[model samples]
Target chain A: MEFSLFNILDLLGTMAFAISGALAAMSRKLDLFGIFIIAFVTSIGGGTLRDVLIGNTPVNWMENTNYVYLIGVVTILTIIFRNKINYLKTSLFLFDTIGLGIFTITGVETGIQNDLDPIISIALGAMTGTFGGVIRDILCNEIPVLFRKEIYATASLTGALIFVLLDELQVNTDITYLVTALTVISIRLLVVKYKISLPFFTLDQKKSPN
Target chain B: MEFSLFNILDLLGTMAFAISGALAAMSRKLDLFGIFIIAFVTSIGGGTLRDVLIGNTPVNWMENTNYVYLIGVVTILTIIFRNKINYLKTSLFLFDTIGLGIFTITGVETGIQNDLDPIISIALGAMTGTFGGVIRDILCNEIPVLFRKEIYATASLTGALIFVLLDELQVNTDITYLVTALTVISIRLLVVKYKISLPFFTLDQKKSPN
Candidate 1:
């Protein structure tokens, strides 16, 4: 509301996530209504879920129509720019990473404000940063990328841990937020740049049908 | 909590939904943790979402551990009797329909108690009865059956509408709930038995790729 740096970052993140969602929906050949729905959910799903869990009534989007409007604009713009979207991939990825960082910190702060356990706070942070994309993937009928690929949630979790640790140490609030967000952004960028991934195992791999 | 008929029906619905979730997970060959997670979400996902939208915090499962224990037992039993599960399909279907009926009424009631608009209340009712299965299908990487198949949400919505209508007529509360639940259950059963389905269309079918 104050046009603060945090506010700007949050808007940017929301837009980036919306564009990503639009792209996914387009790939699936969803109709206009479906694309808007997907874009809206992908941008706000995590934050809405967090607010609901913490008993924040009406959820964030309902209380403030800015997010809804922003997502609407982004969805339309993405549709118009569909052909040139490939050229904007790098910038989109960067904005999405920034969103991941900021969302994770906000989620953690909300949890701490509610006096939730630190572990729960961390989970909230990671969920807030990642669950939107998870929902989007689910709606598109794909296994959530969170469960199968990327270091996405891990980055958010790491950032959340840093936030909790910094807050515990009574660090300056602005510095804590900056550091936490930077940490998440850096981790995600580096992981993708280097093709790094966590090890995965499937139990069904070794067992034959009974 | 009082072991009333509604309470019993609620528990049966929760258990039925949980088993359905567990069965879906096993079909995907997910690990035990994944199966439990799916089952847990499938049983409580709708009510939790409804509560969150209406600003009910700490959610239902957190308030009552009975639901948790019941789901746990259901999941274990489902796994143990996996090979024999086919024999129980009819029974499972019946319980699931009962759950659909009760959950719809409870959702509508919660919305009305919170002084929501009738339309919103009806939407809440349908969402509460159907979203758990929607979430389940998403987790299993399928388009929500509610969106693509069956008269699932339609039945819930119709039941919710009847509930609102009956309440307006100053019907007794118990009678209202009974009629609403039975209406939903009967509609679902009849729809399934008759192999009736809503017509669906995909936009891609008419338009060629650009």
Candidate 2:
């Protein structure tokens, strides 16, 4: 039951990320092939990076053709409905948030399975959640929004920590998943709604008069 | 004998890449930690990505402490002699070329070991030769120069094809390496010297008159 639930959420997350990628490509006015490539990379780049770092061979997408089909479907649908997607913006954002939460847990669990330290697990989790968007932004020729003082990676980091802490405390697995996911989703929504952001750090150029 | 020669060349390449990364960081006026992070990522990001894709666990740097020490020493030395290093730009470019050639071979050999197709091996080789710079450019908030029509990845690709073709023709391994490396270096130098470049592809802004 848990396995099926997680699988469904994973597919949904992939679809949402793919759609976002397609939209980015359209905004950039890329060709059809470019749009497909962008969509595919944006959806899988983060998980692929995390898997590679953890030594998970073949990466997740390579092991399954389902991801390819899903991305293709999402890209086509997005292109066809381009004129109407504005009304679905809020829904897309919600799906993306849910994706962030779920992907974070998946990364943390994979790290744990690999016997990594809890801190590293949390880091892997946050990376899994955030790096896809980073890759997406970079491919589109912009600084990653995550690095631009956004609350995005922070929410993933916080939720990852909470997940690790709860697991260490021996909380029920299902309950732990729920709370951790909720924490990430809530933080992201609240931050976006309120325009909350991390403080920017600039290196001061003035030298001390020693 | 061959192993030691390759090892020395690999170290030289690593050092050159690290220095280049530090130079980039210095140009950006990043903080000390930022400098180190950029240098490290720029030197190893490509190989790490390749290893993970091929299911090599622990990665090369993680398994060997020498890579870390090399990067550290290179980073410090580059920082110390930043001004004088400008005079050595030619030598640095030579080292980077050698590194690209060697890294391309390493990636190809790994792919072959894993029973991947020759075409895939060549792709992996090009990726290994080029993705570090891609990651570095992205992290530094610029579109990758490779994407800007530089003759970089093409050189790697051409060398990789030559390497695979020679191997298939039953050429000796050492000869294969030498020839492939020379091809990449020659192409890179010629391209830079003659200002050769691929045609830029831009999306047509206006609809075609029907």
The whole-model lDDT of each prediction reads 0.79, 0.76
lDDT of 2 by residue, B11-124 (tens): 666776787678778778899989899889988887887877878767778887888988998899888988887656465456566667777877777677677667667767
Off by over 4 Å in 1: A1-45, A57-112, A115-126, A136-143, A146-210, B1-12, B57-73, B87-95, B116-120, B147-149, B165-172, B196-210
* DockQ winner: 1
Worst 10 residues of 1 chain A by lDDT: A201-210
Candidate 2: residue A110 Cα off by (Å):
11
User: Per-residue CA lDDT of candidate 1, range A1-210, in tens?
Assistant: 677665666677788789888888888999999999999988998788788787776777787789999999989999998887675556556656777888888788878877776766776787788778788877988657554435677788899999999999999888988999999999888988888765322222222221
Alpha-carbon RMSD, each predicted model: 7.4, 7.7
- DockQ of every predicted complex: 0.13, 0.12
Tens digit per residue, CA lDDT, model 2, A1-210: 244655665677688778877776666766565566668777887788788888677676655557777898888888787766554445445656777887888778788878999999999999988877777777877667586544788899999999999999999878888888899999988987778877667998899899
Candidate 2's TM-score reads: 0.58
Each model's total of backbone clashes: 0, 0
Q: DockQ (C-alpha) of model 1?
A: 0.13
